[model samples]
Target chain A: MSIASILFAALFYLAAITLAGGLAYRIADYARTPAPLKIPTTPAPTTTGGVVFRMAREVFLFESLFKSNLWIWLFSILFHFGLALVLLRHLRYFTEPVWSWVVLLQPFGTYAAFPMVIGLAGLWARRFLVERIRYISTPSDHLMLALLLAIGLSGLSMKWLVHTDVVALKTFFLGLMRFDVEPLPASGLLYLHLGLVATLMLIFPFSKLLHAPGVFFSPSRNQVDNPREKRHLAPWAAEMEK
Target chain B: MAAEITAPAYRVIPIVPALKPDAMEGVKPFVASEKIQDALGFPGTLPDDWHERAIAKMGELLKKYRSLKVYLDACVHCGACTDKCHYFIGTQDPKNMPVARQDLLRSVYRRYFTLPGKLFPKLVGARDLTKEVLDEWYSYYHQCSECRRCSVFCPYGIDTAEITMAARDILDAVGYGQKYSNEIIGKVHTIGNNLGLPGPALENTMEGLEEDVKEDTGIDVRFPIDVQGAEVLLITPSADFFAEPHIDSLIGYAKVFHAAGVSWTLSSMSSEAANFGLFIGNYEQMRKVALRIRQAALDLGVKRIIVGECGHAWRVAYSFWNTLAGIGAGADDPYALMLQKQLDQRHKQPTHICEYTWDLIQRDALKFDKTKNDHLVITFHDSCNVARASRMGDEPGGQFDIPRNIIRAVANNFVDMDENTIREKTFCCGGGGGLLTDDLLDLRVKGALPRMEALQAVVDSHGVNYLAAICAICKTQFSKTLPYYGFNMRMIGGVHQLVSNAIILENKQ
Candidate 1:
């Protein structure tokens, strides 16, 4: 194994373990912390099925964001959906034989980069332009935006501007997924994209990126609006009741 | 800082301007007096170990409330909720922004709890739990009415109210709490209501209301008290006994009960529905206040408990009462089981008054003379608690419609304020979350600005003379601040007041 390949493999391993383990820990913490009250934001769906539907609209459509602001909704949804497609496209590299669905999604995912870049730019601009947004935004917020933009731009550049050895790149990612290590391709843009992606993964569980899993645990969203139907006593609260 | 606020004489919907950071910096409500704090089972003064105690309390709360921890984790500082708060809009205080307000505690949470915050505090906007930060928490958390306005807008449904509650709980744990909320919570504990209205005072007030209604409509409506074998126990706000428009609504309840021929009694023990413990965000305190209702129900032998028109009280009654006092079924706890066995199982145990009235109206059991309200052009102000926190009927959006339906049944001219300003997106009346005291008058006046603007909008196009709301706090807040906006204080009336005016007696109809 090349030195570069070994280093990259180790970095990927650390990031993967950290991301998965940290998420599990955070999720366990959330699950254990009891919601003593039924705090579903009202007009919230009452049943489990309805809650699923509400979450679907929230996660997929950014329904609440859509209600809040047209501009933030447009950029945020575009960015998230575009990121989804781009992430899906990258799944091809990790799979031994590219899945048929992934093969079919290649063209659409390639175009998704355009909106992803544009969306990140718009979101970034709002940080500096919109006064209230700018006020609430911290240096880390701007830095996070820049990091995402850099990742997207770097990925796009390697695809469109500077063609990389795809066969070598796939081997590298697949090797990272498997124990078999491969020689790392000496492409600057590919390295940039992979490095930034690794950075994002490493920070995912610790940073505000936890919002991805945090959304599901949000009592305001996930709680059933049936407080009047059943008593919702957390163990600690139930102890108090006694 | 001592009553320096010269409130604007004319209503001004503050133009969206550049974010002026720290606009509400010096703005803080007076602390709860030592006696008041002691009365509520809180410390009389800040303890020597307050820092440790406060941090410990935050850790304890972080473990207890999933909403608090989840909200703290979920906020990305995306600023989606920055401009969503009415106080932020009214005061132009960046800290009043829901996200900024959450950050007041989030920064501290990050420092003590999260790894990134410890390693790189400034990088993630994390700060240590210091005295200054505690002061900021005191000021800003009190400013938040816990209305859940920003929660509706948040993509992740990050409830800043949850954060605010946790912060207040932390503050209270450290012997620092606002006077208005603590005083009221203590009063409810001691005298059964925020007004400190004892059984005799309440009885006198009810007698006066009955006579007033008799004079107006010649209906001998009886406001019964602690009558055994009554079918319903009406848990209402004490303001309904002490305040105007609220008292009118109390009369409306009496008339409705009189018309429906339903036996209902008011318990002096749990006389109040407005639980100020909710304002302080102390679960034990909230639960203690709520338990009175269950005890009252058991003592008075009431099968059903119907809540009167109060915002946060309905939210508590509808949302937390089941958990706290066992109003709902399927509780493993013996206390819950005790109450559950007694409450009527066929209907919702604690029902909203609007739902009750609407149910009667739906059944065509109640008749209203709409022409009686012809002198008043009314608009509905959806109280933040009922709008966002609780539901009315079995169906969703019933909270919005039921009150309007009741109004439509009673009144001829009804116009909703700005569409964006009503329903689940309703703004607070600035007096909620226990900021209604004379000391917080400036904060209350400024915080009332967004709501004032919406009310003004309706007045301009629709000539809305009466701003009918279901909250005692809303009625009280608007009664004081509406005159500041050049509207008559009489404009702040309850939905039930309109119902009282137009409710046709069985003999007359």
Candidate 2:
């Protein structure tokens, strides 16, 4: 294996472990911490089944964002949906036979990068243009946008602008999965794209990106509006009664 | 109401105001006195190690409350909630924006807790919990009404109210508690209400109310106090016994009970339903304040506990009362189960007065002469807590509908304010979440600009003369701020006040 392959392989392992383990630890922390009060934003669903539907709508549709601002919602859905397709399409690199759906989704996923880049641009522009959004934006916020934009551009460049040996890249990724390092494509754009993706994975658990899993645990969104019917007592609060 | 503090002019289109950086700098609520702090079990004064203590308190809260932890972590600063805050829109202060306000604490939270913030503080907008930062937290967090309006629009459900509450809790933990909330909480602990009216004083107020009602309507409507074995226990805000328009709603509750023919009594032990502990965001203190209501229900042997018209009071009674004091059902705890068993299961435990009145109106049990309110074309102001934090009837969004229903039944001519200013999207009356104190008068008047603009629109288009509300704070806030906007202070009154004006007392007729 080449030094480039070995370095890339090690970095990917570290990134994957950090992403999964960090998310697990953070998610468990959120799950264990009790929501001492019933704080569902009202007009909320009362039943458990209703709460499930509400959360589904929130996650799948960004329902609150849609209700808030059409501009943010449009860009958010575009980037998120585009990223979803691209990630799913990339499954062809890992699977031995390249799943039938992944094979079929290749064309659509190639086009998805456009919307993904466009969405990120709109979101980043808001950070500079909108006074309220700009006031709240920190260096990390702007940098996060820059990083995502770079990843998207580099990935697109490799795909269309500067074509790399994709068959070798796929073999290198599949080898990494099986702990058998292989030679990587000699492409600067490919390395940059992979490196950025690794960085994003590493930071996912620590940054506001935790919002991905945090939404699932948000008491305001996840909780049922049945405080009158059922009592919710945290362990610490319950000790007060004892 | 201050001479120098000018109210913002009403907008023809109700546009969100432009950012005015530091527009409200140095605008902080009064610091709690040592005695008031001690009354709420906080330190008598700012401790020497306040910075460390505040950080410690934030860490403790992060572990205890999921809302605090998740909210602190989840905010993406999307600015969806930027134009959403009434204070931000009214004051034009970027710091009043929900995201900016939350960052006052989030910055410290990051510096102390998160890895990126510890490693690259400026990059992530994290800072040390310095005296300056704490002072900033104090100024901005109090400006928030804890209304949860921004939470409605957040993509991740990042509630600024939860963050503000957590920030206040940390502030109080380090002897930085606001005077208005801390003092009122102290009053609730000692005198059983925000007004600090003693039992005899409350009795006198009720007696005076009874005499006035009898003289006005030629009917003897008894405002019974501490009556044992009453079927219903009415726990209302002490403002009802003191403040104008609020007292009218107090009489309205009595009139509703008399018309419904229910045996109800007010308990001196828990005469107040407004829980300032909630305002201060101290869970233990909140629970302690709620426990009095439970004790009163048990002591008076009342089967039902119905709340009076107060915004945060109704929120606590409806949402937190069960968890805090066992005022609702399905509790595994013995005390909670005991209280639950004693409360009449047929009706909602600790119901809102509007809910009770609306149920009666629905059943045709109460008669209203709508013509009595013909002189007034009225609009309803959905109190922040009632609009976004609590429910009324069994149906969702019932809190908004129930009050309007009561108004429509009592008054023939009723028009709603702008749709955006009503229901779940309602703006706060500016003097809520313990900012109702006189010290915050300037912030209160200015923060009410959005609501005043919406009201002005209806007044111009629909000739709305009266602004009806269910929450005591809304009535009080609007009554004080209405005159500043070229309207009569008397134009604002409670939903129940309308019921009082038009309600037909069978005994009188």
Candidate 3:
């Protein structure tokens, strides 16, 4: 395999794994904290069908997203969906022959990548423009967005602009999948993209993005609101009071 | 002219025999004893299954979900929540500690759900769900009024109220509920009222109220119960029928309706506005309790239902009524349709009782006869349920202006408590969430101290004779807890009383 191709493939895989591992650790740490969840009670059992509907609404419609500032919602939806689709398309690199459908949809994938760049830009602008959003946005938020944008732009450049040797790239990935180490390729842009993607994944679990799963576990949403007729006593309390 | 005999000069004689001296004396002692017991602490006993069921339920719920399991798993044991709680602030007891309070549920949660808890329980502060643990939860969770104040300050936003509520629900499911809560729920289910005062009692009370209005103001204001075709069904807590402050508030609503010449009726079926289901964590019961008001409105064909000045009731009414009643279904529920129609028709929006009362007093320029309320030197206590959860921040329920307006109307010596005592920052009465029973008296007293302290500030400065509160539970708590704390203040009549007292008597000849 060409040195440049091997370098690019190795960088991407390393970045993704490193990011995912870091995010998982951060999420575990956050889960340990005693954050207050003070959602008002409703007399509906969260598990009783309503919860499924609510979950669906949140996932598909982004119900709370819709309720949030409209511009931010638009940017978030585009960026998230775009990022997800691009990741799926990248699966061709690991496969034996470039997946036929992915090959056919190369143009569409490129088109989708464009929105990832635009959406990230819009979101970054919004953080600077809006008061409350800006107030809450930490330095890490801006850095994360910048990294993702750089990753998307670089990937787009590699696919459309550079047109690097495909056969060499494929051979390099196959070697990596087989645990064969190859020498570095001289694609500075590919290395930059890989680094950005790695950083984003590393930061994911520590950020508010962990709310993706945390919302389900939130006591405000999960707990049933039937307090008028029931008596609740904690065992520890019972002992201490006694 | 000076010697003219006035109408056949009959000798002065009593037309009817007076009560026997012994009988009259006997009636006084009977009344005095009942009053004394009510005023003093009367310790009541819980049922035999109360403790067992509570523990079992707590264990069962802890076993039900991994989310709760995770929550129990997640506690870092920060005591930051302690000072944030109004109850703990009011009461200096170590048990009032928030972490200590949450440990009531968390320890059992840990013992039953976590791996470390199951294998090496002592390592993680985890203990088995014993009867002692259940009793502690009941005591501490009950101490929490579920006001959500601590949650606001919690950095991670760990809501102990949710824990307490979850524990309460598990306890209720297991039949370890409080008597007052259960009995009230039963009454709400059976007779459609919390007090179990059936249709006859409701009618009798309304009729008596009519007579009192006639005798006092010569206005002959008719309190129509179960009157069909009324535009509004005014639902109030049962305490309004018998409780002092609430009764006055009831009269104020009647006066507003009378003055507005609006068609309204009181539902004998769903008389009570306070729903303990909200406190106990029973959704079905909460729905059933709320359903009564909607049913009454539907049965009577009223366009809208107006809930009275009860805190949780308004919260339930505003937040859950439409969802629970299946309102907005295409012709399946006429209540929702009628409510929509009423909303569309009204020039003024339908509002909380507070807003309505306040608006009327402002609109009419109603001058209160200070002499009528001379007995009261008043300060207001804002119920937490109303001040925080309900729409008190912006529009102040329908009667937002009512409490302040009413106090000013009735008492010549009206006094303001601390700045935070009235609006958004008001402390909870601590007896909300069905904690008004004798079993929770200590917690209730402690919880009420912040509020009591605020009131005391006003009382000391203004010599306040009465603490005006709108919620029935708040009234009950304050009425019981005030004297215990050496605050000689009584619950002045609700805002409605001021309206009834101050409104111009139309029949004044």
True contacts kept of each: 0.91, 0.90, 0.02
lDDT, candidate 1, at B426: 88
DockQ scores for all predicted structures: 0.83, 0.88, 0.03
Per-residue lDDT tens digits for candidate 1, residues A1-242, read: 66777888888899899989999999999898888889999998889999999999998898999898889999887898899999999888889788999999999999999999899999999988888887778778988999999999998888888999988988887876768778888877877888888899999999899899999999999988998887787888767644
Residue B234, model 2: Cα distance from true site in angstroms:
0.5
Residue-wise lDDT of candidate 2 within A3-39, one digit each (tens)? 9888999999999999999999999999999999999
Which portions of model 2 show Cα errors greater than 4 Å?
B1-3
Complex DockQ, candidate 3 = 0.03
Q: Which candidate number maximizes DockQ?
A: 2
Q: Residue B376 deviation, candidate 3, in Å? A: 5.3
The better candidate by DockQ, 1 or 2, is: 2
Clashing residue pairs found in predicted model 1: none
Candidate number with greatest TM-score = 2
Please give the RMSD to the true structure for each candidate, in Å: 1.8, 1.3, 17.5
Q: TM-score for all predictions? A: 0.97, 0.98, 0.61
Query: Considering only N, C-alpha and C atoms within 3 Å, which residue pairs clash in candidate 2?
Result: none
* Native-referenced TM-scores of chain A, all candidate models: 0.97, 0.98, 0.74
Instruction: List the candidates ranked by lDDT, beginning with the highest.
Output: 2, 1, 3
